[model samples]
Target: MRPLIVFSDLTLDGYMTGPGDDLGFMVDDPALEAESTGELRNVADAIVVGRKVFPEMSAYWTSAEGDLAHWMNTAPKHLLTTDPSVDTSAWGNTVLEVGDGIERVRELKAKQGGALVVFGGTATVRSLIAADLVDQYWLKINPVLTGAGGSPFTALAGQRRLTLESARAYSSGTVLLVYTS
Candidate 1:
């Protein structure tokens, strides 16, 4: 089965984004961007995201032409959402799975493909982790500290353990931590 991977950036305090979706506290280092984006492309044959992330990310990346853009546009995408009203016809190679996120993801992983990369969607990530469906995690630890913000693991019902797979430091002081369950 293809591995389910979670890629996210968090502050020193483990907040994914500041309160009210304030993303100003997030740092963007060139080196980190290149490395993270490259890794994301390499590992995943398709990206599985929440409905909320699909419109924003698809609009931006599908129109921009680059390695990441090319990968995103051509690669298959699965959006997990319960809303049947969402129209995804404009997005090429995109599928809408309106059911339990974890079960839908598991079905996707069973298909023949590379890893399924998941970005944002903390709720979905937490569900996958709790179900032991995620195989890898790529967390970019930012330097700033957010007193209040979205957490990396919020909806998780219980404690879970992971093994460190690799770590890298960026020029801007952001650290990329890779883990496996």
Candidate 2:
């Protein structure tokens, strides 16, 4: 089984997004995205995202052009959703409906493949964390604080210790923290 990496952005206050789901604090640097996510593209064959994140991800990435966008658009994706009525016709990702939880991820991990990555969905990340399914976490921590916002780690039933693999600081003031569980 290949590694399952959670590649995400978080504010200094540990918020994934600010109030009202404002992502204004996220870095707008194309080079940064290329540098980070682009690296994962080589090893990450598939993406797993929650239903709540797919619409926004699809709408933006389908029209965006770049190496990162190409990976985002072409990756075979598993959209975790209990809703059977969702229109899975999005062109960005080759979308397959999946049960809304971590069981499918568990099964996927047992197979031979490249890494399965969680790019944007916090709920998906949190669920995987709860299930102890995530093998590695690559968090890009931005140097700003959102006093109130969404935390992917919140509401976790218990603690899971992680080993810090590496920490690198980028010129954009975003620090990349990689961990292995």
Candidate 3:
């Protein structure tokens, strides 16, 4: 079974983005970037994302004409969405899973492959966490504070315990915290 991982950058106030989906408040540390890129490479065969996040992310990563962009553009991706009519031609090796998001994720995790990474869907992350399907969490704690904005983590019915597997500080003042549940 592959491990399910959730990755996110959060502000001091616990927000993932500022007003109108402004993510500029998140600090970018060079060392952190290097560490994240290295970790991302370990992710195997597939990337999972929610419907709402797919189009934008797919467009950005696929259209980017650089080394990193080329690599991500070619990776296999699975999108869980209520809307089944999404055109995936732009995203190579992309598939749409039309069913309960959590169930779909479970099915994916059961498959023989590398780590399955969930990038930016807050709702999907909450669902995965509640279902106890996520094995690892890579959270980048940014230095700035966004007074009010989007939250990376949604409210849960109960508390979920996690152990800090590793922690590293970057020269750019960003910290990467890896946790296992």
Each prediction's number of clashing residue pairs: 0, 0, 0
Off by over 4 Å in 3: 65-68
Clashing pairs in 3: none
Instruction: Report, for every candidate in turn, its global Cα lDDT versus the true structure.
Output: 0.81, 0.82, 0.80
- Measured with C-alpha atoms, the lDDT of residue 101 in candidate 2 is 66
lDDT of 1 by residue, 64-159 (tens): 865666777888888899997888876788888988887898899899988998886566666777788889988889999879987767767878
Give, for candidate 2, the lowest lDDT window spanning 10 residues: 91-100
Full ranking by TM-score: 2, 3, 1
Instruction: Give the C-alpha miss distance for residue 177 in model 1, angstroms.
Output: 0.5
TM-score attained by model 2: 0.92
* Local distance difference test, candidate 3: 0.80
Q: Best candidate per lDDT, number?
A: 2
Best by TM-score: 2
**What is the per-residue lDDT of model 2 for residues 88-160, given as tens digits with 9 covering 90 to 100?**
7875455565674677777778889999998767677777877778889888899899899888898678887
